[model samples]
Target: MSQTKIGALQIGSALSSSKVTIQKVLDYESQIKDEACELIVLPEALIGGYPKGWDFGTRIGYRKEVGREQFLHYWNQTVNLQTDDLKDIRQMAKRTQTNLIIGVIEKVRSSLYCTTAFISNQGELNGVHRKLMPTASERLIWAQGDGSTMPLIKTENLKAGSVICWENYMPLLRSHMYSKDLNLWCASTVDDREIWQASMRHIAYEGRMFLISACQYLGSPSSLGFDTEWPDDKELIRGGSVIVSPMGEVLAGPIYGEEKLLSAEINLDDVIKARYDFDASGHYSRPDIFKLNVDQEERIKN
Candidate 1:
Protein backbone atom coordinates (compact mmCIF):
# COMPACT_ATOMS: atom_id res chain seq x y z
CA MET A 1 0.00 0.00 0.00
CA SER A 2 1.31 3.46 -0.87
CA GLN A 3 -0.77 5.11 1.87
CA THR A 4 -1.00 4.59 5.63
CA LYS A 5 -2.68 6.18 8.62
CA ILE A 6 -0.51 7.58 11.43
CA GLY A 7 -1.50 9.06 14.77
CA ALA A 8 -0.13 10.78 17.86
CA LEU A 9 -1.54 10.19 21.34
CA GLN A 10 -1.43 13.59 23.00
CA ILE A 11 -1.64 12.49 26.59
CA GLY A 12 0.32 12.84 29.79
CA SER A 13 1.58 10.65 32.60
CA ALA A 14 -1.05 9.39 34.98
CA LEU A 15 -1.51 11.14 38.33
CA SER A 16 -0.51 7.93 40.10
CA SER A 17 2.18 5.95 38.22
CA SER A 18 3.39 4.32 35.04
CA LYS A 19 1.20 1.31 35.64
CA VAL A 20 -1.85 3.51 35.32
CA THR A 21 -0.22 5.20 32.34
CA ILE A 22 0.24 1.82 30.67
CA GLN A 23 -3.41 0.98 31.20
CA LYS A 24 -4.38 4.27 29.65
CA VAL A 25 -2.35 3.35 26.61
CA LEU A 26 -4.13 0.04 26.34
CA ASP A 27 -7.50 1.73 26.64
CA TYR A 28 -6.63 4.31 24.03
CA GLU A 29 -5.39 1.67 21.65
CA SER A 30 -8.63 -0.23 22.08
CA GLN A 31 -10.57 2.94 21.38
CA ILE A 32 -8.65 3.56 18.16
CA LYS A 33 -8.60 -0.01 16.95
CA ASP A 34 -11.18 0.82 14.33
CA GLU A 35 -9.22 3.86 13.10
CA ALA A 36 -6.93 1.51 11.21
CA CYS A 37 -3.90 3.57 12.09
CA GLU A 38 -0.82 1.60 11.13
CA LEU A 39 1.46 3.59 13.38
CA ILE A 40 0.86 5.55 16.60
CA VAL A 41 3.36 7.63 18.57
CA LEU A 42 3.02 8.50 22.25
CA PRO A 43 4.42 11.48 24.11
CA GLU A 44 7.84 11.51 25.76
CA ALA A 45 8.14 10.12 29.27
CA LEU A 46 4.60 8.80 29.00
CA ILE A 47 5.55 5.67 30.89
CA GLY A 48 7.61 7.48 33.50
CA GLY A 49 6.30 10.90 34.41
CA TYR A 50 8.21 14.02 33.41
CA PRO A 51 8.72 15.89 36.72
CA LYS A 52 8.40 19.40 35.42
CA GLY A 53 9.21 21.58 38.46
CA TRP A 54 11.11 19.35 40.79
CA ASP A 55 14.77 19.99 41.63
CA PHE A 56 15.26 16.78 43.57
CA GLY A 57 16.31 19.05 46.45
CA THR A 58 19.74 19.66 44.91
CA ARG A 59 22.35 22.31 45.64
CA ILE A 60 25.45 23.54 43.78
CA GLY A 61 27.97 21.09 45.26
CA TYR A 62 26.35 19.37 48.22
CA ARG A 63 23.84 16.56 48.03
CA LYS A 64 20.87 16.59 50.32
CA GLU A 65 19.20 13.55 51.83
CA VAL A 66 15.86 14.68 50.44
CA GLY A 67 17.39 15.00 46.98
CA ARG A 68 18.75 11.48 47.16
CA GLU A 69 15.35 10.25 48.26
CA GLN A 70 13.71 12.09 45.39
CA PHE A 71 16.10 10.55 42.93
CA LEU A 72 15.39 7.12 44.35
CA HIS A 73 11.67 7.67 43.91
CA TYR A 74 12.23 8.61 40.27
CA TRP A 75 14.48 5.60 39.72
CA ASN A 76 11.78 3.36 41.13
CA GLN A 77 9.34 4.78 38.60
CA THR A 78 11.54 3.88 35.62
CA VAL A 79 10.75 0.90 33.36
CA ASN A 80 13.26 -1.96 33.48
CA LEU A 81 12.98 -3.37 29.98
CA GLN A 82 14.40 -6.72 31.05
CA THR A 83 12.00 -7.28 33.94
CA ASP A 84 9.04 -4.95 33.56
CA ASP A 85 5.36 -5.11 32.74
CA LEU A 86 5.42 -4.59 28.98
CA LYS A 87 3.32 -7.56 27.99
CA ASP A 88 0.09 -5.58 28.02
CA ILE A 89 1.55 -2.92 25.76
CA ARG A 90 2.72 -5.50 23.25
CA GLN A 91 -0.61 -7.29 23.46
CA MET A 92 -2.50 -4.07 22.93
CA ALA A 93 -0.44 -3.38 19.84
CA LYS A 94 -1.23 -6.85 18.60
CA ARG A 95 -4.94 -6.37 19.21
CA THR A 96 -4.96 -3.05 17.44
CA GLN A 97 -2.51 -4.21 14.81
CA THR A 98 -0.73 -0.87 15.01
CA ASN A 99 2.92 -0.09 15.31
CA LEU A 100 3.77 1.87 18.47
CA ILE A 101 6.67 4.23 19.08
CA ILE A 102 6.56 5.33 22.70
CA GLY A 103 8.87 7.35 24.93
CA VAL A 104 9.90 5.84 28.21
CA ILE A 105 12.21 6.43 31.13
CA GLU A 106 14.49 3.41 31.01
CA LYS A 107 16.14 2.02 34.10
CA VAL A 108 19.58 0.47 33.56
CA ARG A 109 21.37 -0.64 36.73
CA SER A 110 21.76 2.52 38.83
CA SER A 111 21.14 5.04 36.03
CA LEU A 112 18.17 6.15 33.94
CA TYR A 113 17.89 7.27 30.32
CA CYS A 114 15.17 8.89 28.27
CA THR A 115 14.43 6.35 25.56
CA THR A 116 11.98 5.36 22.84
CA ALA A 117 10.54 1.87 22.64
CA PHE A 118 9.32 0.47 19.35
CA ILE A 119 6.68 -2.27 19.31
CA SER A 120 5.64 -3.90 16.09
CA ASN A 121 2.03 -4.62 15.19
CA GLN A 122 2.68 -8.32 15.72
CA GLY A 123 3.46 -7.66 19.40
CA GLU A 124 7.25 -7.66 19.16
CA LEU A 125 9.71 -5.42 20.89
CA ASN A 126 11.55 -4.39 17.77
CA GLY A 127 14.16 -2.02 19.32
CA VAL A 128 14.67 1.28 21.12
CA HIS A 129 16.24 4.71 20.50
CA ARG A 130 17.84 6.29 23.54
CA LYS A 131 18.09 10.06 23.58
CA LEU A 132 21.68 11.05 22.74
CA MET A 133 21.53 14.17 24.87
CA PRO A 134 19.35 15.27 27.79
CA THR A 135 18.52 18.97 27.88
CA ALA A 136 19.41 21.33 30.80
CA SER A 137 18.44 20.04 34.25
CA GLU A 138 17.57 16.69 32.71
CA ARG A 139 21.32 15.96 32.79
CA LEU A 140 21.02 15.37 36.52
CA ILE A 141 18.51 12.54 36.17
CA TRP A 142 19.05 10.88 32.76
CA ALA A 143 22.22 9.43 31.26
CA GLN A 144 23.37 10.28 27.76
CA GLY A 145 22.62 7.63 25.14
CA ASP A 146 25.30 6.33 22.81
CA GLY A 147 24.90 5.95 19.05
CA SER A 148 24.33 2.22 19.39
CA THR A 149 20.68 2.74 20.34
CA MET A 150 19.89 4.95 17.38
CA PRO A 151 18.04 2.38 15.29
CA LEU A 152 16.39 2.81 11.92
CA ILE A 153 13.32 0.56 12.22
CA LYS A 154 12.48 -1.06 8.89
CA THR A 155 9.13 -2.65 8.28
CA GLU A 156 7.38 -4.05 5.23
CA ASN A 157 6.22 -0.61 4.13
CA LEU A 158 8.89 1.90 5.12
CA LYS A 159 11.78 2.95 7.36
CA ALA A 160 11.04 4.84 10.57
CA GLY A 161 12.95 6.27 13.56
CA SER A 162 12.48 8.51 16.58
CA VAL A 163 14.29 11.56 17.94
CA ILE A 164 13.18 12.63 21.43
CA CYS A 165 12.38 16.18 22.56
CA TRP A 166 15.35 18.53 22.49
CA GLU A 167 17.46 16.02 20.59
CA ASN A 168 15.55 17.27 17.53
CA TYR A 169 17.69 20.44 17.67
CA MET A 170 20.93 18.55 16.99
CA PRO A 171 21.71 19.31 13.34
CA LEU A 172 24.26 16.54 12.87
CA LEU A 173 21.94 13.99 14.45
CA ARG A 174 19.14 15.16 12.16
CA SER A 175 21.42 14.92 9.12
CA HIS A 176 22.56 11.45 10.11
CA MET A 177 19.00 10.19 10.49
CA TYR A 178 18.08 11.91 7.21
CA SER A 179 20.84 9.90 5.54
CA LYS A 180 19.03 6.73 6.56
CA ASP A 181 16.25 7.65 4.12
CA LEU A 182 13.53 7.54 6.73
CA ASN A 183 9.92 7.69 5.56
CA LEU A 184 8.55 8.53 8.99
CA TRP A 185 10.13 10.74 11.66
CA CYS A 186 8.51 10.25 15.07
CA ALA A 187 9.19 12.83 17.74
CA SER A 188 8.44 11.92 21.34
CA THR A 189 8.56 15.08 23.38
CA VAL A 190 7.24 17.25 26.23
CA ASP A 191 8.29 20.51 24.57
CA ASP A 192 4.95 22.24 23.91
CA ARG A 193 6.25 25.64 22.91
CA GLU A 194 5.03 27.26 19.70
CA ILE A 195 8.55 27.24 18.30
CA TRP A 196 8.67 23.47 18.60
CA GLN A 197 5.97 23.34 15.96
CA ALA A 198 8.22 25.32 13.62
CA SER A 199 11.08 22.90 14.22
CA MET A 200 8.81 19.96 13.47
CA ARG A 201 7.72 21.51 10.17
CA HIS A 202 11.31 22.36 9.28
CA ILE A 203 12.46 18.80 9.90
CA ALA A 204 9.65 17.41 7.74
CA TYR A 205 10.46 19.76 4.88
CA GLU A 206 14.20 19.20 5.18
CA GLY A 207 14.04 15.40 5.32
CA ARG A 208 11.11 15.04 2.93
CA MET A 209 9.53 12.64 5.40
CA PHE A 210 6.27 12.51 7.31
CA LEU A 211 6.68 13.90 10.83
CA ILE A 212 4.59 12.88 13.81
CA SER A 213 5.30 14.75 17.03
CA ALA A 214 3.47 13.79 20.24
CA CYS A 215 3.83 16.35 23.01
CA GLN A 216 2.56 15.88 26.55
CA TYR A 217 -0.52 17.66 27.91
CA LEU A 218 0.18 17.89 31.60
CA GLY A 219 -1.82 20.08 33.92
CA SER A 220 -0.43 21.71 37.09
CA PRO A 221 1.61 19.40 39.26
CA SER A 222 0.04 21.04 42.28
CA SER A 223 -3.15 19.16 41.49
CA LEU A 224 -1.18 15.96 41.69
CA GLY A 225 -0.20 16.97 45.25
CA PHE A 226 3.36 18.03 44.40
CA ASP A 227 4.69 21.36 45.54
CA THR A 228 5.20 23.28 42.31
CA GLU A 229 6.10 26.85 41.40
CA TRP A 230 3.50 26.91 38.65
CA PRO A 231 0.09 28.41 39.27
CA ASP A 232 -2.75 26.07 40.11
CA ASP A 233 -4.58 27.15 36.96
CA LYS A 234 -1.62 26.58 34.68
CA GLU A 235 -0.71 23.53 32.72
CA LEU A 236 2.75 22.08 33.08
CA ILE A 237 2.84 20.89 29.50
CA ARG A 238 0.29 22.12 26.99
CA GLY A 239 0.18 19.50 24.24
CA GLY A 240 1.27 20.42 20.74
CA SER A 241 0.75 17.05 19.08
CA VAL A 242 0.96 17.38 15.33
CA ILE A 243 1.39 15.53 12.04
CA VAL A 244 3.12 17.01 9.02
CA SER A 245 3.30 15.83 5.43
CA PRO A 246 6.60 15.43 3.60
CA MET A 247 6.05 18.79 1.96
CA GLY A 248 5.74 20.58 5.36
CA GLU A 249 1.96 20.80 5.39
CA VAL A 250 0.15 20.48 8.72
CA LEU A 251 -1.90 17.39 8.08
CA ALA A 252 -3.37 16.62 11.49
CA GLY A 253 -2.85 19.15 14.25
CA PRO A 254 -0.86 21.35 16.56
CA ILE A 255 -3.59 20.85 19.13
CA TYR A 256 -3.14 22.31 22.62
CA GLY A 257 -4.90 22.46 26.01
CA GLU A 258 -6.46 19.02 25.59
CA GLU A 259 -5.87 15.31 25.34
CA LYS A 260 -6.66 13.85 21.94
CA LEU A 261 -5.23 11.61 19.27
CA LEU A 262 -4.28 13.44 16.08
CA SER A 263 -4.11 11.34 12.93
CA ALA A 264 -3.65 11.78 9.20
CA GLU A 265 -3.47 9.61 6.14
CA ILE A 266 -0.24 9.98 4.17
CA ASN A 267 0.90 8.62 0.84
CA LEU A 268 4.39 7.14 0.96
CA ASP A 269 5.04 8.54 -2.50
CA ASP A 270 5.01 12.03 -1.02
CA VAL A 271 8.43 11.42 0.45
CA ILE A 272 9.86 10.91 -3.00
CA LYS A 273 7.80 13.74 -4.43
CA ALA A 274 9.04 16.23 -1.82
CA ARG A 275 12.60 15.09 -2.39
CA TYR A 276 12.43 15.92 -6.08
CA ASP A 277 13.53 19.47 -5.26
CA PHE A 278 15.78 18.84 -2.24
CA ASP A 279 17.05 15.59 -0.83
CA ALA A 280 19.30 16.47 2.09
CA SER A 281 20.97 13.08 1.99
CA GLY A 282 20.98 12.58 -1.78
CA HIS A 283 21.64 14.87 -4.71
CA TYR A 284 21.61 17.99 -2.52
CA SER A 285 24.37 16.73 -0.24
CA ARG A 286 28.02 17.69 -0.83
CA PRO A 287 29.62 14.42 0.25
CA ASP A 288 32.99 15.61 -1.08
CA ILE A 289 32.98 18.65 1.22
CA PHE A 290 31.06 17.29 4.22
CA LYS A 291 31.03 13.91 5.92
CA LEU A 292 29.66 12.59 9.21
CA ASN A 293 31.16 9.76 11.20
CA VAL A 294 28.76 8.13 13.66
CA ASP A 295 30.21 5.65 16.14
CA GLN A 296 27.48 3.12 16.80
CA GLU A 297 29.38 1.55 19.65
CA GLU A 298 27.56 1.39 22.98
CA ARG A 299 29.77 3.31 25.40
CA ILE A 300 30.14 2.11 28.95
CA LYS A 301 31.34 4.46 31.69
CA ASN A 302 33.46 2.61 34.18
Candidate 2:
Protein backbone atom coordinates (compact mmCIF):
# COMPACT_ATOMS: atom_id res chain seq x y z
CA MET A 1 0.00 0.00 0.00
CA SER A 2 1.15 3.53 -0.75
CA GLN A 3 2.07 5.66 2.25
CA THR A 4 0.47 9.01 3.05
CA LYS A 5 2.47 12.09 3.99
CA ILE A 6 0.77 13.85 6.89
CA GLY A 7 1.99 17.07 8.46
CA ALA A 8 1.48 19.19 11.56
CA LEU A 9 2.02 22.96 11.23
CA GLN A 10 3.07 24.14 14.67
CA ILE A 11 2.40 27.88 14.57
CA GLY A 12 3.17 30.76 16.88
CA SER A 13 0.54 33.35 17.93
CA ALA A 14 -1.14 35.23 15.07
CA LEU A 15 -3.51 37.63 16.86
CA SER A 16 -2.83 40.77 14.87
CA SER A 17 -5.88 41.00 12.59
CA SER A 18 -7.97 38.62 10.53
CA LYS A 19 -6.27 39.54 7.27
CA VAL A 20 -2.72 39.39 8.61
CA THR A 21 -3.18 36.07 10.37
CA ILE A 22 -4.86 34.57 7.34
CA GLN A 23 -1.84 35.54 5.29
CA LYS A 24 0.41 33.90 7.83
CA VAL A 25 -1.56 30.66 7.64
CA LEU A 26 -1.45 30.73 3.85
CA ASP A 27 2.29 31.27 3.88
CA TYR A 28 2.74 28.29 6.14
CA GLU A 29 0.56 26.25 3.80
CA SER A 30 2.89 27.08 0.94
CA GLN A 31 5.87 25.98 3.00
CA ILE A 32 4.27 22.65 3.91
CA LYS A 33 3.07 21.91 0.40
CA ASP A 34 6.57 22.46 -0.92
CA GLU A 35 7.64 19.65 1.38
CA ALA A 36 5.16 17.23 -0.32
CA CYS A 37 2.78 16.79 2.57
CA GLU A 38 -0.61 15.39 1.60
CA LEU A 39 -2.44 16.73 4.65
CA ILE A 40 -1.63 19.69 6.92
CA VAL A 41 -3.03 20.15 10.43
CA LEU A 42 -2.89 23.49 12.24
CA PRO A 43 -3.29 24.57 15.86
CA GLU A 44 -6.59 25.48 17.56
CA ALA A 45 -8.07 28.94 16.88
CA LEU A 46 -5.01 29.60 14.72
CA ILE A 47 -6.67 32.36 12.75
CA GLY A 48 -7.41 34.50 15.80
CA GLY A 49 -5.00 33.22 18.46
CA TYR A 50 -5.91 31.54 21.77
CA PRO A 51 -7.39 32.80 25.05
CA LYS A 52 -9.29 35.67 23.41
CA GLY A 53 -10.67 36.40 26.86
CA TRP A 54 -7.83 38.92 27.04
CA ASP A 55 -9.81 41.10 24.68
CA PHE A 56 -12.61 41.33 27.24
CA GLY A 57 -10.64 43.73 29.45
CA THR A 58 -9.97 45.90 26.46
CA ARG A 59 -13.67 45.88 25.73
CA ILE A 60 -14.55 46.88 29.32
CA GLY A 61 -12.26 49.90 29.34
CA TYR A 62 -14.49 51.78 26.91
CA ARG A 63 -17.81 53.46 27.77
CA LYS A 64 -20.78 51.11 27.67
CA GLU A 65 -21.81 52.16 24.17
CA VAL A 66 -18.19 52.35 23.04
CA GLY A 67 -17.51 48.97 24.58
CA ARG A 68 -20.49 47.51 22.77
CA GLU A 69 -19.31 49.04 19.51
CA GLN A 70 -15.76 47.81 19.99
CA PHE A 71 -17.03 44.37 20.94
CA LEU A 72 -19.07 44.28 17.78
CA HIS A 73 -16.09 45.35 15.72
CA TYR A 74 -13.77 42.71 17.14
CA TRP A 75 -16.45 40.07 17.04
CA ASN A 76 -17.10 40.82 13.42
CA GLN A 77 -13.37 40.82 12.81
CA THR A 78 -12.98 37.11 13.80
CA VAL A 79 -12.89 34.32 11.21
CA ASN A 80 -15.83 32.06 10.34
CA LEU A 81 -17.01 29.39 7.89
CA GLN A 82 -17.79 31.87 5.11
CA THR A 83 -14.89 34.27 5.48
CA ASP A 84 -12.93 35.35 2.39
CA ASP A 85 -9.81 34.31 4.30
CA LEU A 86 -10.96 30.71 4.12
CA LYS A 87 -11.47 31.17 0.41
CA ASP A 88 -7.80 32.06 0.15
CA ILE A 89 -6.92 28.90 2.06
CA ARG A 90 -9.22 26.88 -0.19
CA GLN A 91 -7.63 28.31 -3.28
CA MET A 92 -4.17 27.51 -1.97
CA ALA A 93 -5.21 23.99 -1.09
CA LYS A 94 -6.48 23.47 -4.65
CA ARG A 95 -3.29 24.90 -6.08
CA THR A 96 -1.16 22.58 -3.96
CA GLN A 97 -3.53 19.63 -4.10
CA THR A 98 -3.16 19.08 -0.34
CA ASN A 99 -5.92 18.57 2.18
CA LEU A 100 -6.10 21.02 5.10
CA ILE A 101 -7.52 20.60 8.58
CA ILE A 102 -7.72 24.02 10.21
CA GLY A 103 -8.89 25.30 13.57
CA VAL A 104 -10.74 28.63 13.62
CA ILE A 105 -13.04 30.76 15.74
CA GLU A 106 -16.39 30.42 13.99
CA LYS A 107 -18.92 33.24 14.12
CA VAL A 108 -22.49 32.02 13.78
CA ARG A 109 -25.06 34.80 13.97
CA SER A 110 -24.59 36.43 17.42
CA SER A 111 -22.68 33.56 18.98
CA LEU A 112 -19.13 32.27 18.48
CA TYR A 113 -17.85 28.69 18.52
CA CYS A 114 -14.42 27.08 18.74
CA THR A 115 -14.55 25.16 15.46
CA THR A 116 -12.43 22.94 13.20
CA ALA A 117 -12.99 22.78 9.42
CA PHE A 118 -11.71 20.27 6.86
CA ILE A 119 -11.06 21.18 3.24
CA SER A 120 -10.19 18.91 0.37
CA ASN A 121 -7.16 19.30 -1.88
CA GLN A 122 -9.56 20.63 -4.52
CA GLY A 123 -10.80 23.29 -2.08
CA GLU A 124 -14.13 21.63 -1.33
CA LEU A 125 -15.38 22.50 2.13
CA ASN A 126 -15.88 19.38 4.21
CA GLY A 127 -17.91 19.29 7.44
CA VAL A 128 -16.87 21.14 10.65
CA HIS A 129 -16.57 20.06 14.30
CA ARG A 130 -17.06 22.49 17.16
CA LYS A 131 -15.68 22.01 20.65
CA LEU A 132 -18.17 19.77 22.49
CA MET A 133 -17.37 21.49 25.76
CA PRO A 134 -15.35 24.65 26.28
CA THR A 135 -13.13 24.28 29.36
CA ALA A 136 -13.02 26.76 32.26
CA SER A 137 -12.40 30.33 31.01
CA GLU A 138 -13.20 29.34 27.45
CA ARG A 139 -16.84 28.95 28.52
CA LEU A 140 -16.87 32.73 28.90
CA ILE A 141 -16.54 33.22 25.14
CA TRP A 142 -17.52 30.14 23.12
CA ALA A 143 -20.86 28.37 23.03
CA GLN A 144 -20.75 24.61 23.59
CA GLY A 145 -21.19 22.63 20.38
CA ASP A 146 -24.03 20.17 19.90
CA GLY A 147 -23.63 16.57 18.75
CA SER A 148 -25.32 17.29 15.39
CA THR A 149 -22.13 19.00 14.14
CA MET A 150 -19.86 16.05 14.96
CA PRO A 151 -18.43 14.50 11.78
CA LEU A 152 -16.21 11.70 10.54
CA ILE A 153 -15.07 12.49 7.01
CA LYS A 154 -14.02 9.72 4.63
CA THR A 155 -11.58 10.51 1.85
CA GLU A 156 -10.25 8.22 -0.84
CA ASN A 157 -7.01 7.86 1.10
CA LEU A 158 -8.19 7.70 4.72
CA LYS A 159 -11.20 7.57 6.99
CA ALA A 160 -10.38 10.55 9.20
CA GLY A 161 -11.91 12.16 12.28
CA SER A 162 -11.20 15.04 14.65
CA VAL A 163 -11.92 16.47 18.14
CA ILE A 164 -10.87 19.75 19.63
CA CYS A 165 -8.59 20.35 22.67
CA TRP A 166 -9.88 18.85 25.91
CA GLU A 167 -12.34 16.60 24.11
CA ASN A 168 -9.40 14.20 23.58
CA TYR A 169 -9.70 13.42 27.29
CA MET A 170 -13.25 12.16 26.79
CA PRO A 171 -13.14 8.37 26.58
CA LEU A 172 -16.60 8.08 25.03
CA LEU A 173 -15.71 10.58 22.34
CA ARG A 174 -12.66 8.54 21.40
CA SER A 175 -14.81 5.41 21.42
CA HIS A 176 -17.24 7.10 19.06
CA MET A 177 -14.42 7.59 16.55
CA TYR A 178 -13.26 4.04 17.10
CA SER A 179 -16.76 2.77 16.35
CA LYS A 180 -16.58 4.59 13.03
CA ASP A 181 -13.37 2.67 12.17
CA LEU A 182 -11.36 5.83 11.94
CA ASN A 183 -7.77 5.39 10.71
CA LEU A 184 -6.50 8.88 11.24
CA TRP A 185 -7.47 10.91 14.30
CA CYS A 186 -6.78 14.65 14.32
CA ALA A 187 -6.61 16.22 17.77
CA SER A 188 -6.30 20.03 17.86
CA THR A 189 -5.36 21.25 21.32
CA VAL A 190 -4.10 24.10 23.53
CA ASP A 191 -2.73 21.91 26.32
CA ASP A 192 0.68 21.99 27.97
CA ARG A 193 3.58 19.64 27.10
CA GLU A 194 3.05 16.88 29.66
CA ILE A 195 -0.72 16.53 29.29
CA TRP A 196 -0.50 16.87 25.51
CA GLN A 197 2.17 14.16 25.10
CA ALA A 198 0.44 11.82 27.55
CA SER A 199 -2.88 12.21 25.76
CA MET A 200 -1.32 11.54 22.36
CA ARG A 201 0.34 8.38 23.65
CA HIS A 202 -2.87 7.21 25.30
CA ILE A 203 -5.03 7.78 22.21
CA ALA A 204 -2.63 6.10 19.79
CA TYR A 205 -2.28 3.02 22.01
CA GLU A 206 -5.94 2.89 23.04
CA GLY A 207 -7.50 3.50 19.64
CA ARG A 208 -4.75 1.74 17.70
CA MET A 209 -4.96 4.46 15.04
CA PHE A 210 -2.52 7.00 13.70
CA LEU A 211 -2.74 10.28 15.63
CA ILE A 212 -1.91 13.75 14.35
CA SER A 213 -1.91 15.86 17.48
CA ALA A 214 -1.46 19.63 17.05
CA CYS A 215 -1.44 21.95 20.04
CA GLN A 216 -1.09 25.70 20.48
CA TYR A 217 1.24 26.93 23.23
CA LEU A 218 0.14 30.52 23.65
CA GLY A 219 2.43 32.06 26.27
CA SER A 220 -0.21 34.68 26.89
CA PRO A 221 -1.37 34.62 30.48
CA SER A 222 -4.81 33.26 31.23
CA SER A 223 -7.31 36.02 30.61
CA LEU A 224 -8.93 35.05 33.93
CA GLY A 225 -5.77 36.15 35.77
CA PHE A 226 -4.42 32.72 36.55
CA ASP A 227 -0.92 34.11 36.35
CA THR A 228 0.54 37.47 37.38
CA GLU A 229 2.87 37.55 34.37
CA TRP A 230 3.04 35.64 31.11
CA PRO A 231 4.94 32.41 31.88
CA ASP A 232 7.35 32.81 28.96
CA ASP A 233 9.43 35.78 27.92
CA LYS A 234 7.31 36.42 24.87
CA GLU A 235 3.59 35.75 24.84
CA LEU A 236 3.93 33.12 22.09
CA ILE A 237 2.68 29.58 21.83
CA ARG A 238 5.19 26.83 22.68
CA GLY A 239 4.23 24.21 20.13
CA GLY A 240 3.94 20.46 20.89
CA SER A 241 2.73 19.07 17.56
CA VAL A 242 3.32 15.34 16.97
CA ILE A 243 2.38 12.31 14.91
CA VAL A 244 1.98 8.94 16.65
CA SER A 245 1.73 5.52 15.02
CA PRO A 246 -0.73 2.77 15.89
CA MET A 247 1.86 0.96 18.02
CA GLY A 248 2.31 4.12 20.12
CA GLU A 249 5.54 5.09 18.34
CA VAL A 250 6.42 8.77 18.13
CA LEU A 251 6.80 8.99 14.37
CA ALA A 252 7.44 12.69 13.81
CA GLY A 253 7.49 15.27 16.53
CA PRO A 254 6.59 16.64 19.89
CA ILE A 255 8.50 19.72 18.67
CA TYR A 256 8.43 22.50 21.28
CA GLY A 257 9.19 26.25 21.53
CA GLU A 258 9.04 27.04 17.80
CA GLU A 259 6.72 27.22 14.81
CA LYS A 260 7.51 24.30 12.50
CA LEU A 261 6.11 21.98 9.87
CA LEU A 262 6.70 18.35 10.91
CA SER A 263 6.00 15.65 8.35
CA ALA A 264 6.10 11.85 8.11
CA GLU A 265 5.17 9.25 5.54
CA ILE A 266 2.76 6.91 7.37
CA ASN A 267 1.76 3.51 6.04
CA LEU A 268 -1.98 3.01 6.42
CA ASP A 269 -1.56 -0.75 6.77
CA ASP A 270 -0.01 -0.27 10.19
CA VAL A 271 -3.46 0.37 11.61
CA ILE A 272 -4.74 -3.06 10.62
CA LYS A 273 -1.53 -4.73 11.69
CA ALA A 274 -1.74 -3.19 15.15
CA ARG A 275 -5.39 -4.15 15.43
CA TYR A 276 -4.52 -7.74 14.52
CA ASP A 277 -3.23 -8.19 18.05
CA PHE A 278 -5.94 -6.20 19.79
CA ASP A 279 -8.54 -3.51 19.05
CA ALA A 280 -9.66 -1.64 22.12
CA SER A 281 -13.27 -1.33 21.01
CA GLY A 282 -13.23 -4.78 19.53
CA HIS A 283 -11.54 -7.99 20.79
CA TYR A 284 -9.92 -6.17 23.75
CA SER A 285 -13.29 -4.98 25.01
CA ARG A 286 -15.67 -7.52 26.58
CA PRO A 287 -18.91 -5.77 25.69
CA ASP A 288 -21.09 -8.58 27.06
CA ILE A 289 -19.66 -7.83 30.49
CA PHE A 290 -19.45 -4.01 30.17
CA LYS A 291 -20.61 -1.71 27.38
CA LEU A 292 -20.42 2.02 26.85
CA ASN A 293 -23.20 3.58 24.86
CA VAL A 294 -22.74 7.02 23.33
CA ASP A 295 -26.10 8.38 22.26
CA GLN A 296 -24.53 11.41 20.63
CA GLU A 297 -27.67 12.35 18.77
CA GLU A 298 -29.82 12.29 21.90
CA ARG A 299 -27.31 14.33 23.84
CA ILE A 300 -27.49 17.10 21.26
CA LYS A 301 -31.24 16.81 20.81
CA ASN A 302 -31.80 17.81 24.41
Cα lDDT of model 1 by residue, 173-207, tens digit: 99999999999999999998989999999999999
Worst 10 residues of 1 by lDDT: 219-228
TM-scores for all candidates?
0.97, 0.87
Residue 122 C-alpha lDDT in model 1: 95
Q: Which clashing pairs does model 2 show? A: 217-237, 217-238
TM-score of 2: 0.87
By lDDT, the best candidate is 1
lDDT of each: 0.89, 0.77
Q: Give the count of colliding residue pairs in each prediction.
A: 0, 2
Candidate 2, residue 254: the lDDT equals 93
Q: Which regions of candidate 1 are displaced past 4 Å? A: 300-302
